[model samples]
Target: MLLHESQLAQGVFNLTWKVEMSGTIETGHVKWFNDEKGYGFISRDNGQDDVFVHFRSINSTANRKTLQEGQRVEFKVIKGPKGLQAEEVTAI
Candidate 1:
């Protein structure tokens, strides 16, 4: 669902759904990755705190899935258990 600024002004703060209301997608570079552990962090281009990324969150079409350091990517943000995390990630 799309989240317009006006909608947020109306107090739409539901946590059950992944919201991309702002109509903004983010791009970032992989800061580090552990192929064995299947987890890593991405340094957002906006200069925000690095976002955590998991192997399962990647959207890849290749037979082998792996992210290398300095790889550029686009992703959506979700409120994960620990905090904000990258989801629906795809290599850019």
Candidate 2:
């Protein structure tokens, strides 16, 4: 297989680094949601299973207290210790 195709299949080149510490309203599916805890994971575009997003990262302007599972919303990635985390979640 071509390297590009392999990369695409493996979702390696798709990794995101938050150079700007900010991002546009790129949407992702909510994988699991816990309204009581106010935290959840989003299924990112590159097929990642779960990217953690806390309520604190959600924008107040969003006007939503909690997210529903499978809901698509835009967010930014913040570098975390083990991997990456989604932040600044906002509806678009």
lDDT of every predicted structure (CA atoms):
0.83, 0.71
Off by over 4 Å in 1: 1-23
- Name every residue pair that clashes in candidate 2: none
lDDT of 2 at 90: 72
Best by TM-score: 1
What lDDT score goes with residue 70 in model 2? 78
lDDT of 2 by residue, 1-92 (tens): 55677777556433544333436545688888798888878888766546788887777665566887878788877665445678778755
lDDT of 1 by residue, 27-84 (tens): 9999998999999999999998888899988999887677999999998887765667
Pairs that clash in candidate 1: 3-21
- Model 1's lDDT to the true fold? 0.83
User: Residue 74, candidate 1: how far off, in angstroms?
Assistant: 0.5
- Model 1: worst 10 consecutive residues (lDDT sum): 13-22
Deviation in angstroms for 91 in model 2?
Answer: 1.9
